[model samples]
Target chain A: MRRLYTILSAGAVLGLAGPAVAQNPGDTPAPAAQADPATGSSNRARSSQSPAGGLAAVSGEDAAAAPARADGGTIPPAELKSACERALRDDAEWREALGRQLTGALLASLDQRVDDAEPDQPAKKRKLEPWVEQLSTEIERKIHQRENRAIQRNNNHVIMAYAALWALVLGFVVFMWNRQRALKAEIAQLQLEVEEAAADDE
Target chain B: MKQAMYFVFAGISVLLFFYTIDLIFYGTPLDAGLYFNQKIFYYHVPQAFVLFLAVIVAGVASLLYIKRRDGRYDDVAEAAGEVAVLFGAMMLVSGSIWGKAAWGVWWQWDARLTTSLLLWMLMVGYMLVRKYGGPSADRLAAGLAIFGAVNIPLVYFSVKIWRTLHPEASVVPGLQGSMRTTFWLSVLLFQIVFVLLLIARVGQSRIQRQVREVRERALDAGLLD
Candidate 1:
C-alpha cells in the first residue's frame, strides 16, 4: 500500500508538471478518456470540476469510472475521496496499468506542446531547404547590389567635389599667373616707348 | 628669402593636402551616421572657415583704408575680397553637393542657407562694384566689404537664432577622436591655400598700381602720349 501510494503520488506530481494536464478554470482540457494503444490503458480523465480534481484523477484507477455516478449526478466530495483511497489499495496489475497510462499521457502532453510550439515550419523547412537557400542567396545578392550602388555614388560625389575644388584653385592660380604675365608685357612696352621718347628728345 | 619661403610653404601645403586626403578617406573611420557623404564635411567646413577669414580680412583692411586713405590697405582689401569670393564659391558648391547627398535636396531657403547665399551675393556685388563702379568704385566696394564682414556674425549664428536644417557652429566643438584631427588638418590646408592665393593677388595688385602710376607720370612728363 505504501508502495502504491508512492507510485500514485509520483503520477500526480508528473501529471501536474505536464503542460496540458496543468489547467485553470477556463483552460481545462476535455474531460474524456480513450484507450491508449501503446500503453494499452485508458487516457487521462480530466475533471471539469477543477485542475486539482484532474490531478487527483491521475493518481488512481477509479479515474475511468469515477465521473459516472448512477443517478447522473456529480460525485460527492467525500465519496470521491474514499474512491481515491480505494484505488490506492487496488491490485498491483491495476496499479502498474495506471502508472503506464499516466506515463503515456505525460508523453502525449509533451508531444502536443512541442507540436504547438512549431507548426508547419519543420516539414516545410526540410522540403524547402533549397528554395530557402536560394532565397537567402537572393537576399545576399540584393544587399551586395545596394552596397555597390552606394559605393559608386559615393565615388562620384567625392571625385566631383575634389575635382571641382582643384579646378577652382587651379583656375584662380592660372588667372593670377596670366595677369602677372600681361602686366609684365605691358611694363616692357611702356619701357620701350619711354626709351624711344628719351632718344628723340636727345 | 621670403619668396623662397612662400614657395616652400606652397609645396608643403600641396603635400599636406594629399596626406590629409588619404587620412580622410582611408585612415579615418567613417561617421556611423552619415557614412560616405560625411567626407564632404572635411573640405566644406574648412572652406567656409577660410571664406569667413577672407571676409574679415577684407573688412578690416577696407576699414583701415577708409580711415587712412592708404593704397596699401586698399590693395590688401582687394586681394582679400577676391579670395573671399573664390572661397565663397567653393563653400557654396561643396555645400550644395553635400546637401544633395545628405538632405535629398541641393538647396534650401532656411536661415543659415539664405544668409550664406546673401553673404556670397554681397561679396559678388563687391567684386562687380570694383570692376565697373568707376572712380568711386573703391569706396563703394569698401563699404560693401564692411557690410559683408558685419553679416558674417549673422551667418555664423543663424543656425542658433533660427531653427534650420543646417548644422550649428557647435559641430566642430562636438567632434571626437580622429575626426577632430582630420578636420583641423583640412582647415590648416585651406588656410595655407588662402594665404598663397592672397599673396599672389596682392603682389599682382601692387604691380598693376605701379604700372598705372608710371603710365600717368610718363604722360604728364611728355615722355609718351
Candidate 2:
C-alpha cells in the first residue's frame, strides 16, 4: 500500500512540476539583445511603450539588413550601397543611448524591493515615477512589437509541434486499427478452413 | 455498455479539445516576457502531465505484474508503457521547440530537461525490452518499468535539486485569472485523451492475445497438420 502511494505521489509531483513549464527561456536565460524585460504594475497599454525605443533596437539589427530607400528616394545604383551604410551609422549612437536608458530603467525596477511589512508601502515606494513611466512606455511598446514577431514565430513552431503530435497519434491509431482488422480477418478465415478440413475428415 | 462508455469518453475528449481552443485564443495576455512562447504552455505542459501519468500507470502496473505474475497485469503494463513512450516523445519534441524559442537552443542538459530525457529513454528501453527480450521479457521489462517509475520523481524534482535554468515547480503559483482557467481545462482535456488512447491500446493487446490462443487451439486439434 505504501508503495502504491509512492507511485501516485510521484505522478502528482510530476504534474505539479511537469515540463517545469511556463517561465519563458527568453525571459530568464536568453533575454535576446534587448535590455532585460520589465513590466510596470501590469500596465498593458500601447502608451506604455516608446516608439523611438523600438526604432533604436531595430536600427541596430538593421545595420546588417538591407536599406530599401534613403530619405524617401532611391539612391543612384553605385552610391546606394554606401548611402544605406551611412544611413545605418547615422544617429546609431543616439539610438543606442535610448536602448541603454531603457535597459537601465528595467534593471532599476528589478532592483527595487517592495516593503513587505507595510503592504501599501510597495505601491508608494516601488511605483514607477512619471518620467520613468513615460520612458518605460516607449521601451515596452518597442519590446512588445518586436516580441510580437517572436511570438508569431513561436506560434508557428507551436503549430508545427501540434501538427506533428496529431500526425503521430493518428498514425498510431490507424496502424493499430489496420493490424487488428487484418489479424481478426485472417484468424476468422483460418478457423473456417480448419473447420472445413475437420468436417471432410469426419 | 462498455462500447457506449468508450463513445462517451471519445465525445467528451473531442469536446474538451475544442474547449481548449476557445481558452487558448481567449485567455488573458500572458505577462510581458512570457507572452509569445507562453502559447506552447497550453499544449506542452498538459502533454507533459499526460506523460507523467502514463509513466506512473506503466510503473505501477509493471510492479503489480511482477508480484502476481498475471497476464492481465502484464497487458496493462505494456499498454501503459507504450502510451508513456508516445507522450514522452511528444513532450520532448514540444519542449525542444519551446527551448529553441526561449533559450535559442534546441536542447539543454539542464536538470529538469535532462532528467526528463533520461526518464523518456528509460521508458523507451522498458518498451524495447518487452518487444525484443527473451522468454522472460515480461519479468525483465517489469523490472525496467519499476526503474522508470522510480526515476519520475527525480525528473520532476531535478529543477529543485540542481542549479538549472528550468523554471521552478509552482504549477499554479501566481495564476489568478483566465490563465488559471485555461491551464486546468487544458490539463483535463489531455487526461481524457490519455485515457482514450490507453483503453484502445490495451484492448488491442487483449485481442492479439486472444488470436494467438485460438491459433494454438487449432494446432492442438490437428487442424493445422
Candidate 3:
C-alpha cells in the first residue's frame, strides 16, 4: 500500500509538474518584446522598391501622400531595428507587418508583369484579357492561402503545447487518486482487525 | 418511508427526462449570443454534474461506514460508487461526441476533459479498491473517494491558472439570463436522476446483503446438514 501510494503520488506530482515545465515562461517569449528582424528588413526593402521610394527623394512629398502607396518613409535605421526587434518578439505586430508587406509586394509584382506582357490587337487582346485577369486573381488567392497557412501553423503549435500540459495533469490526478484509495483500504483493514480483537476479548 | 422517498425521486426523474427531451425538440436551438454548442449543453453539462454528485455521495457513505462500522453504510457507499462510475463513463462518451461535433475534433486536452478523465479513473479505482482491498474495503474505498473528491477543484482551477484550450465557465456574471436558466434546469434534472439511481442501487445492495446473511445463519445452525 505504501509503495502504491508512493508511486501514485510521484505520478501525480510528475503529471502536474510536466505541464508547468512544458509551459515554461522561456518557451513563450513575450510577443511584443522580440521583433522579427527578417520581417522588418523585408518591409524596409519593399518600401524602398516601391514608387513611394521615388517620393522620398522629392522634398515637397507629404509624408502622408503615399498613405495608400508602398513608399519607403524616412524611418531611421535605429528606430526600424528596434521596431523590428519588438515585432519579432510580438507575434501580432510581426504578423500584421508581414501580411502587409507580402500583399503589397504581390500586387506590385503583378502590375509589373502585366505591363511587360502587353497583348497586341483588339480581338486577340479582348480574348487574352480574361485569361490575364483569371491568372492574377489566382495568384492573389494563393498568397492569401499562404498567409493563412502560416497563421494556422502558429496556432497549432500553441494547441500542441496545451495538450501536453493537460496530459500531465491527468496523469498526476490518477496517481494521487490511486494512492489515496490504497491508504484508505489499509486503514479499513486495520480497523476491522481492531474490532475483531475487541470482540474476541469480550 | 425509504420506499416512498425512492418513488418520489423516480417519478421526478421520469418527468424531467421527458421535459429535457421536449426542450431539445421544441425549444429554440440555444442562441449563439447565449453559448456555443447550445443543444449539447443541456445533456452534457447535467451529466457531468450528476457524475460529480454521485462521487460525493459515495465519499459520504464511505465516511459514515468508517465511523459507525454499519454494514448498511458500506452497502450505500458501494452502490453509490458503482452508479457514479456508470454516470462518469457516460459523461466522458457524451462529452467526446459533443466535442467532435462542435470543435471539429473528437477530443482536445482541455482542462475540463483532463479533469473529467481523472475523475473517471478515480471512480474506477474506488470500485477496484472495494473489490480487492479485502473485507475491510469500505474504509479504503472511502479514503480513495475523499482523495479523488479533493482533486476535482484542482482540476477545475488548473485551466483558469494555465492557458488552457477549454473555454472559461460560461455562467459568469456577464452571461445572459436565458443561458443561465437552461443551464440551471439541466443541473436540476441530472441531480434528480443521480438521486434516483443511487436509491435504486442501494435498495438492491441491501437485498443482496440480507440474502447473504440468511444463508450464513442457516449454515451456522447446521440447517443444510
Candidate 4:
C-alpha cells in the first residue's frame, strides 16, 4: 500500500509538469525593430483606401530596383541610398500591416465575392482584392496549424495515460501471479509436515 | 453492539438515498445538462466509495486472518472481496455510460477510467481464483486480494503522474468550505452503506459454511441409507 501511494504521487507530479514543458515554446515575442507602429496604421488605411493601386506601385518599384541592386557597381550616393532605404522600409512596413488588415477584410468579403465577382461601384472598392484574399488564406492556414498542434498535444496526453495504466496493471498481475505460486508451494510444504506427523502417530 | 451498528448503517443509507434524490432535484445543476449519465452519479459514486471501503476492509481482515488463523477472519475477508467486486462492477458500468454521454464515445483509455477498469478486473479475477481453485485457494486469494487492494492507491495516482485529461484530485489543498461539507457528507453516507453491505454479505457466508458442515456430517453418518 505504501509502495502504491509513492508511485501514484510520483505520477501526479509528472502529469502537472507536462503542460509546462509543452506550451508553444514561449512564442519569442517577434523582434521589436520589425514591429513598427506607423507601419501598422498605414497598412490599415492603405488596405481600406486604394489596395490594388498601392500594391501595383510597390511591385513596379520593387521590379525596377531589383536589377539595379543585382548589378552592384558604383551604386547610388550614401544620402540617396539612405533616403531610399528609409522610404522602402516604411513602405514595406505599411504593406505588411495592410496585408494583415486585408486578411480580415477578405474574410468579411467572402460572401460578397460569391454573390458577385464584379461590384457595381468597382472604383470605390479596394482594388487589390486578390492580394487581400491571398493574405487571408495564409492567416487561416496558420490558425489551422495552431489548432492541429493543440489537438496533437491532447492526443499525446491520452496516449501517455493509457500507456501508464497498462504498465501498472501488467506489473500488478505479474506480482500477484508470482505471490500466488509461492503461497501454494508453502501450503503444500505445510501439508507434507502434517502428513508426516500423522504417519508417526500411526 | 453488532445489532446497534447495523441499525446505524441502515439509518445512514436511508438518509443518504433521500439526500442524493434531493440534490438531483434541487441542487445547482452543472452546465453539462441533465442526462441519464448525470443521474447515474447518485449510484455510481456511492458504489465507487463502497468498493474502496470493501478493499480496505479486506486488507484489515486479511491482517487479522494472518495473525489469528481464525476461519471467521478468512470469512470476513472473502465476504469483503465479494462485495467489493459487486460494487466495483457497478462503478465500471455506470462510469462507462457516463463517459459515453460526456465524451460522445462508449469508452476512453483515460487514466482514471482505465485504472478503475483494471481494479474491477483484479477483483473479479480474485473471486474466480478463490472459487475454482479448491481448498488451498483461500491462501492464494488472500495474497492476491492484499496485492490488488494495495494497487488502488497507485491506480488513483496514475493520472497525477501522467499527463491526463481526467481532472485532478478534488480534495486537494484549495477547496471551498461548502464543497468540502457536501463531499464529506457524501463520504460519510457511503461509508455507512459499505458497513451495511459488508455485514450482510459476511452473515450470508457464515450461514453457507454452517449448511455445508451440516451436509458433511449427514454424509458421514450415511443419513440417506
Best by DockQ: 1
For every candidate, C-alpha RMSD to the true structure in Å? 19.7, 19.2, 21.6, 20.2
The lDDT for every candidate, in the order shown, is 0.78, 0.72, 0.63, 0.61
Best first by lDDT, ranked: 1, 2, 3, 4
DockQ, computed on Cα atoms, for candidate 2: 0.35
Query: Model 2: which docking level applies?
Result: acceptable
Candidate 3 structure quality by residue, lDDT tens digits, B127-159: 899789996676888888877777789877885
| TM value for model 1 | 0.67
Best by lDDT: 1
After aligning candidate 1 to the native by TM-score, how far in Å is the CA of B196 from where it should be?
A: 0.6
Q: How do the residues A80-117 of candidate 4 rate in per-residue lDDT, one tens digit apiece?
A: 66775576567876556555655455544543554477
Better of 1 and 4 by TM-score: 1
Predictions in order: chain A TM-score: 0.32, 0.30, 0.30, 0.36
Clashes of each: 0, 6, 16, 6
Model 4 chain B: weakest 10-residue lDDT segment is B28-37
lDDT of 1 by residue, A92-202 (tens): 577676656564545444444447786754554333322243455556866976896686467667878988987999999999899899999999999999999999999
Clash total of candidate 2: 6
Model 3 chain A: lowest-lDDT 10 consecutive positions: A28-37
Sorted on TM-score, best first, the list reads 1, 2, 3, 4
Say what the RMSD of model 4 is: 20.2
